[model samples]
Target: MMTLLSAPTSPYVRKVMVVAHETGQIDRIDPVFALANPTKANEELNNQNPLAKIPALVTEDGAIFDSRVICEYLDATTSTHPLFPRDGKTRWQALTQQALADGLLDAALSARYELLMRPEDKQWSGWRDAQLAKIERALDRMNTDIPDTLTIGAVGYGCALGYLDFRFPEVDWRAARPALADWFATFSERPSMQATLPRD
Candidate 1:
C-alpha cells in the first residue's frame, strides 16, 4: 500500500482521492490525515514533498508530489476505467481541458492567499482581482465546451468547481455558465465525487 498525506478540506488532496476511487484503486491507498495549511509549513510533509503540500503519495519507489502527477500515476497503473485518455486528438483535448481546470484552481488559490492569508495592510486588491479574472475566463471556456467523457479533464473540473462552491459561493459561477453548471450538477452525483466531498 502507498501512504498519501491527506487533509480533509484540501481540494487538491480531494482530487487525488476521487481519482483513486474512480480508478478502483482506493484500497491500495492509505490516507494519513495531516493538518497542512498555506499559512504555515509542515516539516513532516516537507520530508515527502519539498514544497510541503498534501496529497503527496509516498510510494515504494519514492514520493510523488502534486495532485496532477499522482492522479496520472494512478491512471497509468490502473487497468480499470482509465481517467486519462491514451491517444488521439481526444487525448490532447482531455489534457488541455485538465490544464484549463487546474488553472482555475491555481488562480482561485492565488486570490485566496492574497485576500485571506496575507495581512490586510499587505494585501493587494489589484492582484486579487487579476486572479479572479483568470478564474472567470477559465470558467467561460469550460462552460462553452464541457467535457463529455469521464477523463482526467472531467475529474479536474469536478474538483475545481467543487472547491469554488465550497470556498467562493459568493462568486455566482452558475449565473452565466449554465452549461458548465449543469454538467457539474450531474458529475457531482458520481460515487467518487460523493465520497470525496470536501468538509470543514
Candidate 2:
C-alpha cells in the first residue's frame, strides 16, 4: 500500500483522494495526516518532502510530492479507467484544464494562508487582493470554457470550485458565475466527488 501524507483541509489532497476513488485505487492509499511548517523544528515530513507539503505519497521505492504528479501516477498505474487521456489533443486539453484548476487552487490557498496562518501584523492586504483577483479571473475563464460534459479537466475544476465553497464561502464565487454554479451542481454529484467532499 502507498502512504499518502495529507491534511484533511487541503484541497490539493482532496484532488488526489478524488482521483484515487475515480481510478479505483483508493484502497491502495493509506492517508496519514501531517503538519508541516517551515518554522517547526525536527519534522520528518521535511525529509520526505524538502518543501514539507501535504499530499506527499510514499511508495515502496520512494516518495512523490504534489497532487498532480501523484494523481497522474495513480492514473497510469491503473488500467481500468484512466483519469487522464492516453494521447493526442484530449490529453493536452486535460492537462491544460488541470493546470487551470491547480492555478485557481494555488491562488485561493495563498489568500487563505495570508488571512488565517500569517500573523495579523504580517498580513498583506495587497497580496491577498491580488490573489483574489486571479481567482476571480480564472473562474470567469472557466465559466466561459466549461465543457457540456465531464472530463478530467471538469473533474479538476469541480474539485477546485468545491474547495472554494468549503473554505471561502464568504467570497460568493457563484453569484457572478451562474453558469459555473450550474455546471458545478452537476459535477459535484459524481460518486467520486461525493465520496471526497470536505467535511468538519
Candidate 3:
C-alpha cells in the first residue's frame, strides 16, 4: 500500500483523498497524519517531500508531492479515466477549471494563514484583504463557469468550497453565486466528497 502523509484539515489533502475514493484506490492508500506547519518542521514529511507538504504520497517507485499530480496519478491508476478526460477540448477545459479551483484554495489558505499564523503585531490586514479579494474574484469566475461534469475540475471545486465552509463560513460564498452553490451542493453529496470531509 502507498503511504499518504496527510491531515484532514488540509483541502489539498482532501482533494487527493476525494480522487482516491472516486477512483477506487482508497483501500490502497494508508493515511498517516502529518502536521505541516509552514513555520515548523516535520521530519518524517520533510524526508519524503523536501517542501514538507502534506498529501505527499509515498509510492513504491518514489514520492509524489502536490495535490494535482497526486490526483492525476490516482485517476490514471484506474482503467477508466473518469476524473480526467482523454483528450480534446473537454480535457483542457477540465484541467483549466481544476487550476482555477486550486488558485482559489491557494488564496483562501493564504488569507487564513495570515490571520491565524502571524503574530498579532506582525499581522497585516492588507495582505489578508488582498488574498480575500483574489478569492472573491475566483469565486466570481467559478460562478460564471461552473463545472457540469464529474472531472478533476469538479473534485477541485468541491474540495475548495468545502474548505471555505469548514473554515470561513462567515464569507457566505453562496449568496452571490447560486448556480455554483447549487452545483457544489450536489457535488458534495457524492460518496467521494462525503468520505473525505475536512476536519480538525
Candidate 4:
C-alpha cells in the first residue's frame, strides 16, 4: 500500500482521503500522520516534497506533491468510480470547477497564514482583506455554477467549503450563498465526506 503523509485537519489531505474513499481505493493507501510546519524543519517531508506540503503520496515510483496532481493521479489510476469525466465539455467543466475551488482554498489558506504565521505587529489587514475578497468572489461564482456531477470539481468544492467551516467559522460564507450552502448540505452527507471531515 502507498503511504499518505497527512494531518486530519489539513484540507488537502482530507481531499485526498475523500477521493480514496469515494473511488474505493482507501485500502490501497496507508494514512500516516505527519507533523509539517513551514517554519520548522521536517527532513522526511522535505525529502518527499521539496515544498514540505501535506498529502504527499509515497508511491512505488516516487512521491507526489500537491492535492490537484495527487487527486488526478488517483482518478486516472482508479477504475472503481472514475471521479474525473472523460474528454469532452464535461471534462473541461469539471477541471475548471476544480481549479476555481482550489483557488478558494488557496485564498483562504493565505489569509489564515497571514494571521497565524505572521507576528501580530507585522500582519497586514490589507493583505488579509484582499485574500478574503478573493474567497468571497470565488464563493459567489461557485453559487452561480454549483456542479451536479460527481467529479473532481465536487470533491474540490467540498473540501474547500469544509475548510472554511473548520477554520473560519466567524466568516458566514453560507449566508450570502444559499444555493451553494444547500448543495454542500447534501454533499456533506456522503460517506466519503463523513469519513474525512477536517478535525482538530
Candidate 5:
C-alpha cells in the first residue's frame, strides 16, 4: 500500500484523495495525517519532502511530493479509468482547467494563512484582499466556462470551491456566482467529493 502524507484541511490533499477515489485506487492509498506548520514539523516529512508539503505519496519505489505529480502518477498507474485524457485537445483542456483550479486554491490558501496562521498584528489585510480578488476573478472565469460534463479539471475546481466554503463561509461566494453555486451543488453529490470532504 502507498502511504499518503496529508493534512485534513488541505485542498491539495483533498484533490489527491478525490482523484484516488475517482480512479478506483482508494483502497491502495493509506492516509497519514500530517501537520504542515512551523510548530508541527515532523522530521519524517522533511526527509521525504524537503519543502515539507502535505499530500506526499510514499510508494514502494520511492516518495513523491506535491499533489500534481502524485495525481499524474496515480492516474498513469490505472488502466481501466483514466483521469487525464490521452488526446491532444481534451488533455489540454483538462490540464488547463487543472491549472486554473490550482491558481484558485493557491490564492485561497494564501488568504487563509494570512488570517489563521499569522499573528493578528502581523496579518496583512492588503495581501489577503489581493488574494480574495484573484479568487473572485478565477471563479468568474470558471462560471463562464462551466462545462456540461464533469471532467478531471472540473473535479479539481469543485474541490477548490468546496474548501473555500469549508474554511471561509463568510466570503459568500454564492451571492454573485449563482451558476457556480448550482454547479457545485451538483458536483458535491458525487461519491468522490463526498468521500474527501473536509472535517473539523
Candidate 6:
C-alpha cells in the first residue's frame, strides 16, 4: 500500500483523502499522521518532502507532494471517476477553479497563522484583515461560478469551504453566499466528503 502522510485537521490532506474515497482507492492508501508547522521542523516529513507538508504520497516511483499533484496522481490510478479532465477548455476551467479554491485556502491559512503562530506583539491586524478580504473576494467568485461538474475543481471547492467551516465559523460566509452554501450542503453529503470531514 502507498503511504499518505496526513493529519486529520489539514484541509489539504482532507482534499487528498476525499479524492481517494471518491475514486475507490481509499483501501490502497495507508495514512500516516505527520506534524508539519511552518515555524517548526518535522525531520521525518522534511525527509520525504523538502517542504515538510502533509498529504505527501510515498509511492514506488517516489514521494509525490502537495495536494494538487497527489490528487492528479490518484485520479490517474483509477477510471472510476476521473477528477481531472483529459484536455481542452473544460480542463482549463477545472484547473482554474482548483486554483481559485486553493488560493482561498492559502489566504485562510495565512490569516489563521497570523493570529495563531505569530507572537502577539508581532502580529499585524492589517495583514490578517487583508487575508480575510482575499478570502471574501474568493467566496464571491466561487458563488458567481459554482462548479457544475464533478472534477478536481469541485473537490477543491468542497475542501476549501469545509475548511472555512471547520476553522473560521465566525466568518459567517454563508450569509452572503447562500448558493455556495447550498452547494456545499449537498456536496458534504457525498460519502467521500462525509468520510473526510476536517477535525482538530
Error of 2 at 9 (Å): 1.1
- Quote the positional error of residue 7 for candidate 4 in Å: 0.5
Give per-model TM-scores. 0.96, 0.93, 0.97, 0.97, 0.94, 0.98
For candidate 4, lDDT tens digit of each residue in 31-136?
8888887688888888999998898999999999898888889889877666788789998999999999989988998999899889899999999999999999
- Residue-by-residue lDDT tens digits, candidate 1, 150-180: 9999998999999999999999999988899
Task: Please give the range of 10 consecutive residues that has the lowest summed lDDT in model 4.
Answer: 78-87
Whichever of 1 and 5 has more lDDT, that candidate is 1
Q: List model 6 lDDT by residue over 45-145, tens digit each.
A: 99999988887999998899999999999999887757899999889989999999999999999999999999999999999999999999999999998
For 1-200, candidate 2 gives per-residue lDDT tens digits of 99998877778888898888888889999998888554575377887888888889999989997888998898888787567888988788888888999999989988888887899999999999999999999998998888654456877898899999898888898898899899899888889889888876
lDDT of 5 by residue, 73-136 (tens): 8889888556688788878888888889899998988888888889899988999999999988
Q: Model 5 segments beyond 4 Å from truth?
A: 38-40
Predicted structure 4: lDDT: 0.91
For model 2, give the 10-residue run with minimal summed lDDT.
Answer: 35-44
- For model 3, the run of ten residues with the poorest summed lDDT: 77-86
Would you list the rank order by lDDT, best first? 6, 3, 4, 1, 5, 2
Cα-based lDDT for every prediction = 0.90, 0.85, 0.91, 0.91, 0.86, 0.93
How many Å off is the CA of 143 in candidate 2? 0.5
- Best model number under lDDT: 6
Cα lDDT tens digits, model 3, 52-72, are 888899999999989989998
After superposition, candidate 6 runs with Cα above 4 Å error: none
Q: List the residue pairs that clash in candidate 6.
A: none
